[model samples]
Target chain A: MVSQLTRNERQLALVILSALALCGLAMAAIGRDDLIGGHGAFILLASLGMGFVVTSGYYHAEPSDERLAHYYDDPSKVGIVLAMIWVVFGLFIGDWVAWLLVYPEMTFDGGWASFGRLRPIHTTAVIFGFGGNALIATSFHVLQRTSRARLPDQLSPWFVLLGYNLFCLLAVTGYSMGLTQSKEYAEPEWYADIWLVIVWVTYFVLYLRTLARRKEPHIYVANWYYMAFILVVAVLHIVNNLAVPVSIAHAKSYSLFSGVQDAMTQWWYGHNAVAFFLTAGFLGMMYYYLPKKAGRPIFSYRMSIISFWGITFMYMWAGSHHLHYTALPQWVQTLGVTFSVMLLVPSWASAGNALLTLNGAWHKVRDDATLRFMMVAAIFYGLSTFEGSFMAIRPVNALSHYTDWTVGHVHAGALGWVALITFGSFYSVVPWLWKRERMYSAKLVELHFWLALAGTIIYVFAMWNSGIIQGLMWRTYNDSGTLAYSFVDSLIAMRPYYIARAIGGLLFLIGAAVGFYNIWMTARGALEESPTNADRPAAVPVAARTIEAGE
Target chain B: MDIDHNIAVVVAKSFGLFYLIALSIGVLVYVYWPSNGKRFDDAAKNVIHDEDAPWH
Candidate 1:
C-alpha cells in the first residue's frame, strides 16, 4: 500500500484534505453570524490553498539523467488542481462579496464598500492566480517537448513559480486593503507592480534562455507565440501601470496619464492584456497540445507563420476599438475598426490549422475526451472571433458596447476557447505526467465535457438574447423619436439571463469538480511510476539526432 | 458594383495567391534541401568544425 504512493502524492493528498478540514471548521465557526471581515478570511484561505499546492511535492520534478530532463511528472494534474482551486475561490469570493452587501453591518464599510476593496482581489486571483498558473505550468511542459531542450536551470523554474504566486499574493492583498491605481486591469499599487515586474522579467529571461539552448534547429511555432506573449505583455504592463504611489504602505497611487489620454492608455493596456496575456498565450497551448493529443503532425507550418504575424500586427491596433464613439480621435477609431476586421483571418487560420491537424485522426475526436475538448475549443474560437469582428463595427458597437452582449462575447472566448483548451490540454497531460497508462474514467471525462459544454452554450445564448433585446430597447426611436423602453425595463429583462448565467456557472463548477476527482485518482494510480528522465539531462545535439522514417 | 468593390475583389485574390505561393516555396525548399546523400567537399569539411554550430 505504501509502495503505491510516491512521496509527492502522499504529501499533496494530505495537504488538500487538511485545507478542506480548515474550510469546514471555519464555516462551522461562523454558523450563526457571517464571518467577520469575510474578505480577509477568504483571502487567507485562498492564499493558503494556492501556497500549499505550489510548495507541495507534486509541483516539482526531481533531476533526471537526460541532458535536459523531461517533466518526468504530469503538469496536467497541476493545472487541474489550480483550475479547481480557481473555481472554488471564485465562487466563495463572489458569494462572500454578495453576502457582505446583504448584511452590511457584518463588517467595516459594509457591503457597498467591500466591492471596491474585494472585486480586484477576486479578479486578480482568478485571472493571474488561476489562469496565469495554468499558462506557466502548461508552457513549461510544451516548451520543453517542442524544443527538445531540457529546462535550462531548475532554480529559475522554481523562481518563476514562486515569484508569480508571490506577485499574485501582493496584488490581491494590496487590492483588498484599498491599495490601487484605479486603472481597471492594472490596478495593483506601486509595490505590487514592482513585484510583478521582477517576476515577469525573470519569466522573459528564463523563457529566452531555454529557447537559446533548444535541441531542435528551428524554434517550433508554439515557442514563437509564447515568446511574443511574454515580451509584448511586459511592455504593455510597464507602460499602462506607470504611476507614483503616495506611500508604499498607504496603498494610494495616481496614474501618469490624465483625461482622454489616460482613458486611451488604460484600454490599450486592458484590451491587449487580453490579446497577449489571455489569447496569445492560450493559443500557444492550443497549437501544441491539440496536435500532440490527436497524434498528428501540424497541418500547415506555413499557415502558422502567417497567422502568428497576422494576429500580432492586427490585434495591437484593434485596442482602440474598445473606445469607439468616444473622443479618441476619429482616425484612431477608424484604425481600430480596420485592424479589428483584419484580425478574423489570422484567428480563423489558427483554428483551421488545428482542425486540419486532426484530419486523419478524426476517429480520436469521437473517442478521446482530450481531443473533444480541443476540437470544441476550435469551434468556439471560430465562433467568438466572428462575434468579436462583428462587435467592432461602429453601428454594432453602438448597440452592443455597453450591454451584456460584450460580457457574453468575452465568456465565449474565456469559457469556450480558453478554458476548454486548457481543460483538454490538462486531460491529455495529466496521465502522461503522472505516468498512467490511461485516465481513471473516460466515461466521467465525457460526462464532464458534455455538462461543461452545455453549460457554456446555455450561458452564452441567454446573455446574447438579452443583450440584443436591451440594445434594441435602448436605441429604439418611438413615433415621436423618444426611447421605446426605459433603462429599468432593460435591467428587468436581464434578470432571466443573470439567473441562467448563474446556473451555467454552477454546472461548470460541477464538471470541474468531476475533472479534479478523475485527475486525483489517476495521480494515485501513477504514484509508483519511477521518475525516468532525471538528472537534468542536456538536450541531445541536433545533427547527431537520427530521424525515423515516416509512418 | 463600384470601383471600390472591384479593388477589394482584386486585392483579396492577389493576397490569396501570395499566400499559396509562399506555402509552396516553403514546401519545395524543405524537400530540396539535403537531408541525405549530399556530401559536397566544402560543406562536408564545414560539418566537422562548423563555428556556427547548432547548439549542443
Candidate 2:
C-alpha cells in the first residue's frame, strides 16, 4: 500500500508517524504511573512500528502519475482487511461472554477478564473496529463512484484510515485495562476522545474535498447519508465527551453533567450513535452496493429524500426513550416515546425503498447469495425498527428494560441487519476491488448466508423467550400478593437459553470466518481463470460507457 | 412541583411541537417539488456507474 504513494507522500507518512511518535513519547513520560502511561507506551510502540513499515518500503520506485486517472483504492483495501480481523476478534469475544453467562466460572479469576471489562471490549471491537472500518472503506469506494471523482489526495485518506484504527486500538486496549469513564458507548477516557476528534475532523474534510471535485451535477443519496453519519457522529462524540480530566497523568475524568442530566446526555449520545454510526452509515453502503449488485435503479428517489430528512429530524428526540420510567422527568420520556413511534415512518421508508428497488431483481436475490444477504438485511431492518418503536413505549419498556429482550432487539439489528448488509457489500466489493470475475467459492457464500440466517433466528428467539419468561416471573404474584419466584429462579430458568444463545453466536462466528476466507482467497486469485486479464480491472460496464457519453 | 419548572416544560413542549410541524412541511416540500423529478431520476440512474474508474 505504501508503495502506491509518490515518494513525497511516502515521506509525508513518515513525518506524520514520527510526529505522533513524539506525542506518544511525551504521554508515556508524563503518565508513567497510570493507565494513561500504559496506553501512551502502546501508542509510542505502535507508531514506531508503523514508521518501520513505511521505511522498509520507502525505496520502491515511485508510482507513475498515470495512476491519477483511477480512484485511490489501496486504503479501502487495507480498511476491509482490518475490518474482517476486527469482526473475528469482536464476535469471538461476544460468544465468550455468552458462554461465561452459562458457566460463570469460565473467567480466569475475574479482574480484567471479568464480564464487565470484556463486554466493552466486544462492543468496541465490533462497533468501532469492525463496523467503523467497513464504513470508512465502503464510504471511500461509494463516495468516489457516486461523485465521479478521485479522492483529493492519496496521503490524507491513509492518514484518516490508519489514524482511525489507532483510535479503535487505543479504545479496546484501554477498556481491557479497566480504564473507562463508565459511559456506555463513549467509554474511552479523555485522551482517546481527543485523538478521535483529530482523526474524525480529517475524515470529514477528506470526504468534502472529494465531493467538491465531483463531475456529477447532483450529489447521490448515499453521499447524503454518509455525510450525515460523519457530521452527526462528530457532534455526538464531542458533546457527550465534555469532561475535565483529573490531570494529564491520570486516565480518569469528571463529566460536566451530573445525576439526571448526565444520564440524559449519555443516552442522547448513545442512541444517536446507533442512528448515525450503525444505521445511517451502513444505509449509505446499502444504497450503493445493493442497487449495483441487483443491476437496478433505486426505487424512489423522492422517498429517499423524505426518509433522510425524517430520520434526521426524529432520531435525536428518541434517545430520551432509553431513560423512560427513570428520573428523567415524565415529559421528556413522553417526548421520546412520541418521536420513537413516529420514527417508524422514515425507518420503514428506507427499508421499503431498498426492497422495492429489487422489484425486477428477485430472481437474482433467489439465485445469488450475495443479493440474498442484502434482501434479508432490509427485512431485518424493517422488523427491528418496528420492534424498537414498540419497546420504546413506557409501558412496554417497563417489562423490557434491563431484560434480555433489549439484548435480543440489539442483536436482531446487529446480526440480522448490520452484519448481513456488511457481508453483502463486502462480497460485492471484494471481487470488484480484486478485479475478479466472481468470488473464489459461491458455495461457501451460500453456506455463509444460511449459517448467518439460522444463527440470527436462533439467537433472537432464545433471547426473546428468556427475556419474557424472566419478566413475567418477576412480575408474577403468588396468592396474597407475595412474589412467586426468586431472582435465582429466573437465572436457573434462563440457563438453557443462555447455552442456546452461545451456540447461535458460535455459528455466526463460523460464518464470518468463512466469509473472510472466501474474501482472502478471491484476493489471492485462487479462482481466477484468466490470470493475465485478472490484472486489469473488469471490462468496463456497458452502462458506464453510455453514461459517460451522455455526460 | 414548582411553577417555574412547569412553565419551562410547557415552553419546551410547545417549541418541540412547532419544530416537528416545520420539519414535516420542509421534507414534504423537498420531496414533492415539481422540477426535482428529472434531476433526482438522473442521479438515481447514474450514481453507481463507472465503478472502477472516474468519469473522465
Candidate 3:
C-alpha cells in the first residue's frame, strides 16, 4: 500500500516525520515546567499523532485510474476542506472575542485564553487560515482552467498546501504562548515569517511555470490578479517582518524599526495586506467565477486590464492614510488621501464590470443562490471601496479613527464582500471537483445566503451607530469649554453595542456552519436524485468566442 | 542652508510626481494599443474556450 503512494505523498510523509522528531527534541530541551512550554509540547505531540493517522490512511488508498486522466484537483480538495474547518474555527473565536468585550470577566485570570492573546489568533486564523486557503484552492482551480495547462507538477502544489498550513499552525500556537514581534498583521516572529517566505516563493514559481506551459496563446486576466497577489504579498511580508530574534531557540524577536518609524511600517504592511491578500486575490476569484456563473463574457476586457493596473498602482500609496494625525509627515498623509480617493475610479470600474456582466442573467441569479451570492458580493465590493475612500479623507479619518466605525468598515468588506464571494465560489467548485450532480441541498444554499446577508447587515449597522455616538461624545464640550463626557461614559455606551455585535457574529457563525454541512453532505453523496445533465459544459458567451476566433 | 533644503524637497516631489504620471500614461497606452487588441480579446476568452476540459 505504501508503494502505491506517489512521490509527492511520500516526500510529505518524510517531512512530517522529521518535524515530529524535531518537536520531540525541542520539548525535551524546553522542559515541561513552564505552562506555555507544556502547551506547545502538547500541541506538537497531538499534531504528530494526527499526521501519522491521516497519512497512513491516505497512503493505503488506491488512486483511481480514471482520475489520473482528469485535472489535478486533490490539493484543491484538501485546501477546500481545510478552509471550511478554519472558517468555522476562526468565526467561533471571533464571536468569543466579541463577547469578551461585553463580559470582561470572561478572561478568568488572563493567561493564554485572554482577549489580548486570542485576538491575534482570531484575525490570523480567519484572514490567513480561512481566506488564504480559499484563495489558494480557488486560484489553483482557476489557474488550471484558465491557463488550459496542467500544473507543472503535482509535488509543488502539495508542498505549498502543507507548508503554508504548517506556518499558520506555528503562528497561532506561538501567539497563544505570547510570542510576537508586536506587528499588527505581520505579528508572526522571524522564524515563522521566514517559513512563509519559502512557501510563498515556491507558490509563485509554480504559477509562473504553469503559465509558461499554457495551451492558450494569451494568459488570462484572472491569473494576472493572482500573480499580483502572490508577488506583492511576498514583498510586503518580507519588508514588514524584518526582525532580530534574541536567540535561535527563543520565540522573542525585536523589529528592525522603532518608534514612529515602526508605526508607519506596521500600517503600511497592514493596509497592503488588505489590498493584496483580501482584494486582489479575491478579485481573481471574482473574474473567473462571476462570469462563469452568469454564463456571460466579462462586460469589458479592456476595463479589467485598465483597472488591474490602476488598482495595483494606486493601493501602494494609500497606506499612509492609516497614520493620519501622527508624526509621519503631513505630506505623506496628503499623498495617502489623494491616492485613496483616486482608488475609487478603478474599484468602481471592476465592480461595475461585474454587475454589467449579469445584464441578461438576472433570472439565473434569481434561480441560483450561488449567483446571488456573487452579485451581492460585487455590490458590497463597490460600497466598501467607496466607504474606504471616504474614510481615508483626513476629516473623516479624524471622526472614524479609534472608534467602532473603522471596525464596522473592515467587517463590511471582510464579511460582506470577501466571505460571501468565497462561499459562492466554493458552492460552484466543490460539486465540480467531486463530479457530483449539483449539491445535496439547493434549499440550504438559499438559506445560508439570507443568514449571511442578515448577519452582515446587523453587524455593520450596530457598529456604525456605536462608532458615531462614541466619536461625538468624545468631542462634545461643556459651555465652559471643558470636555463633557468622561472616558467611562463612552465605555458604558459601548456595552449595548458590543452585545449587539456578538449576536451578529453568532448569526454569521451559524450561517457558515450551514454552508459547511451542506457541502459535506454533498461530498458524501447524500442527495436523493442526481441531475442528468450534471456534467454538461457550462454555457459560454457566443459573441466573445466569435470575436476571439476572428482575432 | 534653508534655500538648499527647499530645493531638495522640490526636486524630490516633482521627480516622484512626474514619474508616476509617465508610468500611468504608459500603462494606458500599452493596454489600449491597437495591435494588442487581439491578444486581450483572446485572453478574455481563455476561460470560456477551455471550459470543457481544463487539463486537456
Candidate 4:
C-alpha cells in the first residue's frame, strides 16, 4: 500500500512517521515520572500506533487524477479534518464549562476538570485549534485559486498545519497540567509560544512566496485581508508574549512588563487577538466564500479596499479600550474609546458590501442553506461590531464591564459570525474537495442552520438579561445607602441564564455533529450527486453585470 | 524626567492621531484613484475568472 502511494503522498507519510518517532524519543527522554510527562508519553505512543493505520488507509485509496489535479495540495484536506475534530472537542468543553458555572460542585475532584483549568482549554481549542485551522485551510484554498498558483512548496504547508496543531496540543495540555503565565488568551508558556512563532513565520513566508508567483496580474482583496491577519498577529504575539523563563526545562515564565504597563500590554494583545484572529482572518473567509456562494462579484471593490485599511489602522488603537477604568493612563483609555467608535465605519462598510453583493443572488441565498449561513453571518458581524463600539464607551463600559454582557457580546461575534461563516465555507468547499457534486444532505444543512441560529439567539439573549440584571443589582442602593445585592445574589440570579446558555451550546454542538456526519457521508460517496446546471456559466464575467445594480 | 515624560506623551498622542488620519486618507486616495480602477475591478473578478482553472 505504501509503495502504491504517489510520490508526494509517500514523502508526506515519511515526514509524518519521522516526526512521530522524534516525538516518541523526546517523550522517553523526559521520563514518565511526572503526571504531565506520563500523559504526554502515553498520547504520543497512541498517536504513533494510529499513524500507521491512517497512512496505510490513505495509501490504499485511489483518488481520480482529475480530482487530485484540481486541488494541488492535500494539506487543506488535512486541515479541514483537524478543524472538525477541534470544533467538537472545543464546543463540548465549552458546554461543560458553561454547565460548571451553573453547578460549581460538578468539579468533583477539582483537578483537570476544574472550571478554571478547563476554561482556558476551551478557549484555546476553539480559537487556536478550530478557528486557526479553518483560517489556514481556507486561506490556502483561496490564495491558490485566486492567484492561479500552487503553494510554493508542499512541505511548508504541512509543516504549518501540523506544527500549529502541535502547538495547540502543548498549550491545551499545559493548561490542564496547571502550567501557565496567566495572560488570559496568551496563557501558553514560553516553549509553546516559541514553537508557534516559528510555525507562523514559515506560514507568512509561504504566503508571500505563493502570492509572488501568481498568474493573475492583480492580487485579490481576500489575500490582502489574510496577509494582514498573518502579519499583525505575528507582531502582536511576539510583543505580548515577551517573557523570561526561570529555566528552559520547565513550563514557567515571567512577563517582561509589570503593573499598569503589563495590564495595557495584555489587553492590547487580547483585543487584537479578537481583531486579527477572529475578525480579519474570518473576514478573509467571508470575502472569498460569500461571493463564491452568491455567484457574484463583491458589491464595491473600492469599499473593500477602504475598509481594509480603515480596520487595520484603527484596530491597533482600539485595544486600549479593553483597559478602561484601569490603572492605564486616562489619555490612553480616551484614545482607545475614540478609535473604537471610529472603527464602526469600516466594520459597517464591509458588512454592507457583503449584504449588497447578494443583490441578484437573493433567490440563491433563500434556496441555499450555505448562502443563508453567510448572509446571517454578515448580519451578525454588523450587529456585534455595533455592540462592541457601544460597549467601549466609558459609561456603557461601566455597566457592561465585569458582567456577562461582555461574554454575550463575544459569543455574538464568535459563534454567530466566525463559526457560521466557517461552516458556510466548509459546506461549499468540502464537496469540491471530495469530488462530490453536492453534500450528502442539503436538508441536514438546513437543519444545522436553524439549530445554529436558534442556539445563538438563546445564548446571546440569556447573557444579555443575566448581565443587565447583575449590573443593575450590583449598583442599586438600599434606603440606608447600603449595597442592595450581595455577590452571591447576583450569582443566584445568573443560574437560570447559565442553564439556558448551556442548552444553547448543546444545540450548536449537536448541529455541528450533524454537519460532520453529512460531510463524512458525502466523502464516502453515499450521497446522490446534483445534476449540473448547464444554464449557469462556470465563471460569470463581472462586466456582464452592472455594478449599479448592487448599489 | 518630567519633561521627557511630557515629550513622550505629546509624541505618542500626535503620532497616533495625525499619522492614522494621514494613512486613512492615503488609502482612500489610492483606492479611488482613476488609474487603479481597472486593477481593482480585475481583482474583484479574479476568483470568478479562475473558476475553470484546474483547482476550483
TM-score of chain B of each: 0.42, 0.69, 0.65, 0.67
Q: List, for all models, the DockQ compared with the true complex.
A: 0.05, 0.67, 0.55, 0.48
Candidate 4 lDDT over A302-376, as tens digits, reads: 999889998998898898888778887788898889989999999999999999999788889988999999999
Q: What lDDT does each candidate get? A: 0.71, 0.92, 0.85, 0.85
Candidate 3 C-alpha lDDT tens digits along A1-551: 33334656666766765675476557546745543355346547655765675566664545555544556777898899899999999999999999999988898786888988899999998999999999999999998888777676666787688778878887888888887677887878776788799899999999999898777767778888999999999999999988887665566778889987888788888899999999999999999988887777788899998889999988998999999999987887998999999999999999999999998889999989999999999999999999999999999999999999999999999999999999999998888888886888888888999989998998999999999999999999999999999989999999999999989989999999999999888888788444544787866799989999999
The A-chain TM-scores of all the candidates are 0.81, 0.95, 0.90, 0.89
- lDDT tens readout by residue for model 1, A91-202: 4464454444335455674533477777777667656777788888888876776655656655556546655776677676666556667887688766557657887998
CA deviation > 4 Å runs, candidate 1: A1-80, A91-109, A112-119, A526-551, B1-56
Give the poorly placed runs of model 2, Cα more than 4 Å off: A528-551, B1-11
Look at candidate 3 and tell me the lDDT of residue A354: 92
Quality class of the docking in candidate 3, CAPRI style:
medium
Give each prediction's root-mean-square deviation over alpha carbons: 12.9, 6.4, 7.7, 7.8
In candidate 3, which residue pairs clash?
none
Interface RMSD of 1: 11.7
lDDT of 1: 0.71
- Estimate, for each residue in A1-551, the C-alpha lDDT of model 2 and write its tens digit: 77888899999999989988988998899999998888889899999999999999999998887887898888899999999999999999999999999999988995888999999999999999999999999999999988889998888988999999999999988888899999998999999999999999999999999999998879999999999999999999999999999998899999999999899999999999999999999999988999889988899989988889989879998899999878989988998999899999999999999999998889899989999999999999999999999999999999989889999999999999999999999999998898888989888899999999999999999999999998889899999899999999999999999999999999999999999999989889898344432466778889999999999
lDDT of 3 by residue, B1-56 (tens): 46664674687499878988998899889888999998877666656553546455
Would you estimate the TM-scores of all the predictions?
0.75, 0.94, 0.90, 0.89
